[model samples]
Target chain A: MTNPTAAMLVIGDEILSGRTRDANMHFLAGELVRHGIDLNEVRIVSDDRDAIVTAVRALSEAFDHVFTSGGIGPTHDDITADSIAAAFGAPIDVRDDARALLEAHYARTGMELNAARLRMARIPDGAALIDNPVSTAPGFTLGNVHVMAGVPAVFQAMLASVLPTLTGGSPLLSQSLRVFRAEGDMAAQLAALADRYADLSIGCYPFHKDGVFGANVVVRGADGGRIDAAMSDLARDLGL
Target chain B: MTNPTAAMLVIGDEILSGRTRDANMHFLAGELVRHGIDLNEVRIVSDDRDAIVTAVRALSEAFDHVFTSGGIGPTHDDITADSIAAAFGAPIDVRDDARALLEAHYARTGMELNAARLRMARIPDGAALIDNPVSTAPGFTLGNVHVMAGVPAVFQAMLASVLPTLTGGSPLLSQSLRVFRAEGDMAAQLAALADRYADLSIGCYPFHKDGVFGANVVVRGADGGRIDAAMSDLARDLGL
Candidate 1:
């Protein structure tokens, strides 16, 4: 009756240092909800090993599935694979299948398979490789954690492979209507509407743009009919 | 000396449901770094009381300071003030000072402070009120967590008031340059650069855009002189 829950662990210093915004979290959140997996929480940590290990253990235990992005590349800061191995107490080595993929990729590109490049082939023991069609470096699923690259294109491709394997429930549907009224003005009636549609999650997000103050009322649920009913009622009552 | 470490707990179902992207984390991360605080972790959870309380307790214990956003509004979904109170086991009621602020603002604006608006005056015991210059509803500081508004304008305004009060260390400095090179080709030199400048955090972030595969190599440290020296050495060595 309930969807499986998931948490995302984004490992990177660039994000925490304010060099980049975490686009992966947003992308994964939208895709997970569409796949019928309820995203319960998301944690962004630096590239420190202890931080990674601790967060992995905590979120993995709390949710049915865990998706991690970042720190899985070839740079010196890339330590997600080793950290995931440490988190699960799994022995990690350069797996033959992963190495084969990397080796074939380098050969095709006329690049050397040096020791630094070989780091991409490291996978924790007993983990399954999540295919990366965008890049040859494979993301792996160890225990309940799916570790993928930080790069947006590669991460999206890896998720396309991993999401189908997981069990999901009915996809959540949402409908929204924007009204030119202050949130304070709409709070009471909105609360009443929320009470009437007990099955739906009614959320009012206020916005102030171009000297106009208004709110966007959104209703979400597993049933599309309930979402439509609530949204229509909201529109009729709010006169928008 | 280690700078004060901080974490952010974003409370909203909108972010987790993919309905909204958390712009506040990015904004806060940049501001905190400028203020010399190391933002080590960020967690985004839905607008659930138990989830908020548990995250508040965990992050509050782990970091020196915690900044929370969202769920502090007039609507029924705005449960942050009560949740923070529950997290600290503090009794919550309509604090007189908060009520006065709302009362005065409503009177001046010719709007009545109705029951829903009065909900904004509820504050936990012993929590200091955080001034909301844009809106009269004040955010509060209970324990180490600074509970603030979710709206970006109001959140930024509240932070301007809150930041000057906290003690800050030397600001973190960073410098970066873009080079049209694949991550695989640059991994070795980047690792060598990172090792040479152990005092700084040297990170190479890869990107694929407009049919160009390149990376931005960034160097960060508290010491401006050290960062400059490291960046110069990187430029000379990598021939960027």
Candidate 2:
């Protein structure tokens, strides 16, 4: 059977404005792959309400799971929670469970849970809260969408909390052979090899460094034996 | 007047599979912002023909310009050129100018221009060539979409060739104040400040590093005076 598929939505004006380089997509991609889930697509959008709502709905419908990062903080720009609620047509308010977590944490730290801070307690009607070990505010899941924090450390922590609950399939296996020749020289042979191994995804990534031109021929598949056989043939063809 | 808007399409299975982190997006984002072109969206899709075609068509129609990176190499998986042609309903073939350039480069380098190498000469109908300073293979601009090589150096070179030909708007100006206070402590004040400056985009990016909690408050707009004024007020409000 095919592995479960996922799509990611990154929401932040800092990323779109060229002020921040997004680390969450890469982190999530690696984690999902390791867990035997296929991350099919990723979209990075600005902190606009309409854009976030549209992307969340489309991706949630298309893939098995939709993961989103950013716009969950307490500042004015943190509108992801509300936009996600609007997308599902779910009524959102400050839920008691979420408020209690924030309230307890703030009380221990001698801080007041003011209006702006309480905004983090808002959640959709039928959503489950994802634990945030790095901070007090919790991310929530509504339908198939998993909302997480934008900060790298907090995003990673949230993923750790949420990944164990999902079901996965066989992990994808990959092997590579580095060919110290120009991609143009090996293109025809590689194409014939790929045609022969139709089930395996054979890719040639070209690289040029230190006056050397070469390509990395990677073979990826679920069957380890098939991948081994393909790699052996590829090595023989390239005379590696 | 509003700045010209643009979108980016990153085409590669390596990216979606989590084997490679995309640096081109960050580089292009900075370049587009510097040129006064607003980057509205970015999509990363695998090296599938249908996916590439659909994304290119959608992004081309939705934005003023679409910039695409990856899947333009000489291997079998490099089908971006063909897919782009199909997206625009334009026929593609090896043009004489492109072929001549490749032939001369190979001859000078003591290499043969074989079938695989000649594949790089294929250009869609009515498309202009974007010069590649790092390699002999040329990128092309078809209508509103500009297709470039996936390699970071080559992509940057192609962008340099294309950016000068597009129109730009007023550059966005930004100023920032670093507040050494927890986000929860400053959320209320920051929200009030953001509301006060309606025209400027005020965002607070939180950070927790080395046992300290703080945030960076940024004010962005086209007017330098307004940005300076906002920054001064933010600094005083936060007592930074």
Candidate 3:
């Protein structure tokens, strides 16, 4: 659990081309932050197999964990499962566990589980199923990569199921102070304070208002006491 | 105007560490599609100067236009102005045009334009300033890279100003047909239809509901007639 490094691969043409406003990226980013995982990189690619395989391989190897969103549906563009399996050099088939879930879901509601629907049950060999409570189609974990749905609701539920399984370090704690001053004015003091509180990661987020300049100073650390102390010191120094 | 290729470079530590869920990516993606621009690649990097400079150069060279969001604030971490100038090998200083805007904004609102606030007025040599109606601190464009604020509102306003100035191709037209079948069931038909409409780009979006699988087939092209014809043929083939 040493410095959980993670990367996000948003696979969707709608997102890349701007047809769909992506809600999952923001949701996942917030989740990763709360779990004390460092999300290092994010790449949004179209629903292309070559691109998905290339990005999945590169990111999975580079980071401790890789989370992918979009694809894995019952559509023509939903080729993520097969592509990821191909990247991992594994054979993909209709897994019994996933098929069972699909069957149970269909049986309960009395619907036909057609071939198009069966595509959702396909899982790479030796992969663990990630439950999707929102939808019967389950996500899977192969190696360090977790393949989840693109829809915000289903993706979030799948992420929740997969998160508890991973090993995480101390949960990242943060405190923010909304200050009515420019970042440059707080630079010297903030720098000095950040330097003093070596354990905390101090960030200055500057925003513009109705013709006013202001910044939000965020102090993050694994230690709650350190973050609190640093934030208090920052406020005192800024005369907040 | 030939293809109108574009890339987005998101500069912010908040985004990299998953502290900020970026909305600009999706917004810009949709905007690019409407403007007849092809969004090829997207990279989210930290607020580090070297990272910003590196991404700016690579993306600006590779694509016809490179748009960046975040780290353009009046804070210490807002090093985008300096980094963009450095990437272009240009000198960065307080520009008269930008300064006038900031000074006038502060004067009208009766707020002090302190040194920290004035940092927002800095611009690179030969760069054009972008209007920020939401905030007084203007974004600037150096070479092909257009820098904007991270806030969704301000970023969108800046884009409105910048978009009209850029050369764009014919606006892309899109049409969609909703099908009540799984992706795999519709895969073969969708693929065949996509081949038939070779001049158009067709996408199949799948959604699952209460043991039922359905898809929305989207056909996109420059001509409305072509898009409608493709959708009509698709709907007939799917028996919808």
Candidate 4:
């Protein structure tokens, strides 16, 4: 069977506006790689409903799994769940399980479970709830889309709980060779190496230091031994 | 006049595979914002030719400007220029200007400008070259799309030169207030504040610490004086 593929939809206006740098995409990418699930694309959209709906539907159909982070909070702008549910043609309502979890959480802290706070209880029909360790507002999985909180801690916790349930491919393997040459100079040789090993992904990342140009060529594939072998061939071909 | 909007297309398989954490998107987003340009969307796609062609065509039509990073190297996988040219129905050939630049760079460094290196000189007809401070291989601009180096430093320098050539909208003004309260508890008040200032983008970013929930409320607008007024009213309403 082919490798299981995934996509991430980071929903936040703050991220798109340059107000907040996203840390979730990297975290989830690494986690998915470790589980042998390849994350092929990432789309970061504003908190607009149409944008959310369009992205969710498109990404859900394109990949084996889709994980969305953000816009699940109690605020009026937090519309991810509703949009996602609508995209799946699944009606949304306050589920009893989610409500009980929120009620118990607020009761323990002696806080008001007001209308705004209860907004977190909305979930798509026929979805399995993913528990948040840091907070009581539960994330849920509808079809292949796993919805999580925007806050990093809660999102991470929910993702950790959800990932174990999904089927993963062979974990990706990688090897790196740091070259003290400019990427442009080594581009052809590197390209040849990439072509030689069609299964491996060879990336030439350039870094500059005080007028000196350098690059790190990372060769990645599903097999650790094959990746290392390909890296050796690249180093010899590039004279690195 | 409407704000000059730009979107970034990051073309690379490495980024999608979780092999590399992207640094270019964040850099471009901040730089574009500082230059009074709005970055509407960013799409990270693999080295597939059709994907690049489709995205380039769509983004070039939608935004005032499109900045693409990665996939301009000498490798077989570096197909950005060819794909972009296909999108514009333009011929891709090795231009005299780009070849001369590469020759001069190789001459200065005492390196051979081999056939592989000469591949770097391929540019779409009618494209103007953008200077690369960190490397000799040049990036270029075709219409509204500015193809940039994937290397962060080189990309930043090329972008610097490009920004001075374009017209911008009114600079985006912003003010932030860090408050100690959960997002759910602060939702009603923040919503009212947002409703009062319809022109402003009021974002509430929540943070948790020591079993406490806190949020930073950022107010953004095109007008400096109006942003300040809105922020002041927000602080007064929140009593912070």
Candidate 5:
């Protein structure tokens, strides 16, 4: 059976404006593959409400799960939470549970739970809170969308809490063979192999290292046996 | 005047599967902003035809320019060239100019211009050839979408050639101030400042470093004087 599909929506002007190179998309991609959920797509948009709502709506409907990073902070540009609420057409306000979490964290840290800080407590109706261990602000799961922080540490902590609770399929298995040759040299063989095993995904990634060319043929599938078979055939045929 | 808006479509299974960390997005993002093109969105999709076509069409129509990286190489999974043709309903085949470039390069490198290698020459009709100096394969531009190589060097080289040919708006100028305060502490004031300087785009990005919280207030706009004025006001108000 196919694995559950996921899409990531990264919300930030910092990333889109080249002020920050995003780490969450790659981190989530690796984590999702390890968790047996196929990451189908990833969209990074600016801190615009319309962009966020449109992208989140599209991704939430297209995939089994949608993980968003960034814009859930206590700042003018941090509009992701409200935008998400608008996308689902759900009413949002400062929930007591979320406020208490923030309040307690601020109390312990000797910081004020002011108007801006309390923005973190705003949760959409009927959404489950995803705990953030790195920071006090809790992420939330509204419908199929899991809105998390943009910070790498906080986003990781939130995903760690959310992933285990969700249903996962068999982990995707990958087998690879490296050949010190140009992609064109083995492209035909790889194509034939891909055709032979239509269920498996065979990818040829080329590299230039030490003034030499090489291609790494990776075979990915849900079945380890299928991946093994494809890799074995590939390795033997390539004389490796 | 507002900059020409652009979007990026990163087509590859390697990136989505967590095999490769995409460097092209950040590189292109930085380049575009410097070139006065506002990068609005970036989408990373797997090597699927329907997904590629859908994303390319949407991005191409939504923005003034759409830059796509990956899937233009000589591999079975590299379906970007064909997909772009399908997206614009343009016929694709081995174009003479592209083939000649590939043929001459292969001849110089002493590599056979075989069928698989020849796939690089397949350019869509009514498209301008993008010179790939790093590698022999010529990326193409069909309508507003500029199909570029995924390799860092090649992508940069193609961009260098393409950027000069396009009309660019005034270079977006940015001024930033770092304040040693939590985002919540300064968020309300920042919001007021944003309202005051409605024409300029002000972004407050928070950070946690060395057991302290801080936020970087950045003002971006086509008018350097406006950006400078906003930053000065923010600094004065925050006592920074």
Candidate 6:
């Protein structure tokens, strides 16, 4: 069976402005691959409400699972949660369960649960909260969309909390062989090999470093035997 | 006048597989911002043909400019050029000018211009070549979309070659004020400040470092005076 497909939506102006390099997409991509899900697409959009709503809605409809990071904080620019709610046409308010969690955490810390802080408690109806062990403010899940924090630590924690609940297929296995020749020299052979092993996905990445031209051929597939045989054939063809 | 808007399409299986973190996006984002072009969206897709064609067509139609990185090499997996041509309904073939350049470079390097190496000479109809100073292979611009190499160095060179040809608006100016208080503590005042200067885009980024809670409020606009004034007002309101 084909693995469940997923998409990631990164919502932040910091990323678009080049103030921040997004780490969440890479993190999620690795984790989802490990969990046997095919991450088909990833989109990074700014903090604009319309962009967030449109991306979330489109990705949520196109993929089996949609993961989003950023803009769920207690600030004016933190419009991800609200935009997601609007995308689903769901009414959102400060839910008691979420508020109680925030309130109790703040009380324990001797901090006031003010209006801005309470904004984190706003959740759409029928949505479930994703736990944040790094911070008290929880991310939430509405339908297939998992809205998480922008902070790297909080986002990772939330992903760990949410990943166990989803279904997965066989983990994709990959093996790489480095050919110390120009990609042009090996293109024809590689193309023939790829045709022979149609089930396995072969990727050629060219690299030029220290006066050496080479390519790394990575083979990916669910069947380990097929991948192993393909690698062996490639090695033989390259005489390596 | 509003800044010209642009979108980026990153095409590669390595990025989606988490084997490589995309550095081109960060580099391009900074460069576009410097040139007064607002980077509105970035999409990363695997080396699948349909994925590349679909994203290129969508972004090229939606934005004033579309920049794509990766999959333009002499290998079976390098299908970006073909996909882009398909997206624009343009015929692609080995053009004499591109072939002559490749032949001359190969001759200088004492390398044979074989069929695979000659593959790089293929250009889409009506597209202008974006010079690759670092390498002999050339990138091209079809309609509003500029196709670029995936290698960081080559992509940077292609961007440098292509950027000066595009029209730009006033460069965006920005100023940041660091307030050593929780975003929750400053959200109301910050929201009011943002509303007061609606023309300037204000972004609040929360940080928890060294056991301290703080946020950096960034004010961005085309007018330097407006950005400075808004930043000063934010600093004063925060008692900084």
After superposing candidate 2 on the true structure, give the runs of residues whose Cα lies further than 4 Å from its correct spot: none
User: What is the lDDT for B128 in model 2?
Assistant: 94
Candidate 3: docking tier = medium
Question: Which scores greater on DockQ, model 3 or model 6?
Answer: 6
Writing each residue's lDDT as its tens digit, candidate 2 over B107-174 gives 99998899988889999999999999898799999999999999888999999999999999978778
Residue B141: error of model 1 in Å? 0.9
On DockQ, the leading prediction is 5
- Report the lDDT of model 4 for residue B160: 86
- Per residue, candidate 5 scores C-alpha lDDT tens digits across B1-240 of 778999999998888989889998999988888889999999999999999999999999899999999888888988999999999999999999999999899999999999998999999999999988788799989999999988777888999889999888777778888888889999889999999999988898888867788878889888888888888888888887
What does candidate 6's lDDT look like per residue over B1-240, in tens digits? 799999999998899988889999999988988999999999999988898888998898889999999988988888888999999899999988889889898999888888888889889999999999888899999999999999898899999999999998887778887788888989988889889999988999887867788888888889998888887888788787
- lDDT tens digits by residue: candidate 3, B1-240: 357888898887787666666788889988888888988778887776886787788779878999999877665567888999999999999889999999998899786787767888999999999999877799988889899988888899999999999988877788877788656667878878878888888888777677676777788778899888888888788887
Docking class of 2: high
- Please provide, for model 1 over A58-147, each residue's C-alpha lDDT reduced to its tens digit, 9 standing for 90 to 100: 999999999999988888999999999999999999999999999999999888888888999999999999999987899999989999
Which residue runs of candidate 4 sit more than 4 Å off their true CA positions?
Answer: none
lDDT, candidate 2, A92-185, per-residue tens:
9999999999999998988889888899999999999999988879999999999999999999999999999999887888988888999998
Give TM per candidate: 0.98, 0.98, 0.86, 0.95, 0.98, 0.98
DockQ of each: 0.80, 0.82, 0.51, 0.61, 0.84, 0.82
With a 3 Å backbone cut-off (N, CA, C), the pairs that clash in candidate 1 are: none
lDDT of candidate 2 at residue A35, scale 0 to 100: 88
lDDT over C-alpha atoms for residue A205 of model 4:
69
At residue A200, give the lDDT of candidate 6: 89
Indicate the worst ten consecutive residues by lDDT in candidate 4 chain A. A182-191
**Candidate 1's error at B239, in angstroms?**
3.4
Comparing candidate 4 with candidate 6, which one achieves the higher TM-score? 6
State what share of the real interface contacts each candidate retains. 0.78, 0.79, 0.67, 0.57, 0.84, 0.79
The DockQ score of candidate 3 comes to 0.51
